[model samples]
Target: MADYNRWMNERLYDAAATLPEAALFEDRGAFFGSLFATLGHIVAADLIWLNRFVQLPALAELRGPLSALPAPTGLRDRVADSLPMLRERRVQTDVVICDMVRRLEPVHFDEVVRYGNTAGASQAKRFGPLLQHFFNHQTHHRGQASTLLFQAGVDVGVTDLNALIPHEA
Candidate 1:
């Protein structure tokens, strides 16, 4: 799932890069309003989850570095206003995610974590399923971005996870 997340994000960013600046940030009335917002939301949400995941003792080393940037205040925050900056942030976030997953021990998944939602509600859940939600959330918004891009006449090409599967005899 981490690999899929990275792969799809790279594809989306690549496709979005071809568009002129205005089209990228135009409000099309989708959930996040535009391609830029959709991607920004993904990065923001990923940081939220990464911050949660790093709470586990095994991942504590990542906590400080991930804290370097001010945590996003809300999912709707326009975290990055430009393609270049957003793309850079997206890559950096993906690197942190991939590294965090690599260092995770199987036991880490079973541990429960507590976090505050954007709405200020308290919540607790197992780390494993939250990780699933993390990646799935990315796929969901990326799908929206793809549709919006297509509406704007840009194609992200084939996006199936099967494309990454190895062929075997």
Candidate 2:
């Protein structure tokens, strides 16, 4: 999953880098209003989840780049003011996520973590499913980002998970 996340992000950022600054920042009517803003939301959400995950006693030893990142003032806070800065932060965040996943033990997944949602509601759930949501959330926003990219004339080739699967010999 970490590999796939990194692979997709590389493709997305590569295409995004080719886009003109005005086009990338233009309001294209996407959920977050613009491609840059949408990407910022993904980074913010990832940091928020990683911070929550580390709070679990079973995962207390886990730490990475996210620990040093400033908490988003809100879910929609712009973590990066520009596309170049956002891309840099995105790569850093992805590395932290991959590193965290690489260090996870099976027992850690079975533990439940308690944390407050962005809405300020308290919640508790198993770490396994929470991890699923973490990755799924990335894919979700990336889909929106891909659409934004396509509308701006960039092609992010072959996004299917099957592309990463190994075939039998």
Model 2 segments more than 4 A misplaced = none
Clashes of each: 0, 0
- Residue-wise C-alpha lDDT for candidate 1, range 57-115, written one tens digit per residue: 88899887788654786887666779999988888888888888899888988999898
**Model 1: lDDT to the true structure:** 0.87
Can you write out model 2's per-residue Cα lDDT over 96-153, one digit (the tens) per residue? 8877887788998988889889899999999999999999999999999999999999
* lDDT at 68, model 2: 67
Q: With candidate 1 superimposed using the best TM-score fit, by how many Å does residue 72's alpha carbon deviate from the native?
A: 0.4
Lowest lDDT 10-mer window, candidate 1?
Answer: 69-78
CA lDDT for candidate 2: 0.87
Query: In model 1, what are the clashing residue pairs, if there are any?
Result: none
Best by TM-score: 1
- The regions of model 1 sitting more than 4 angstroms off are none
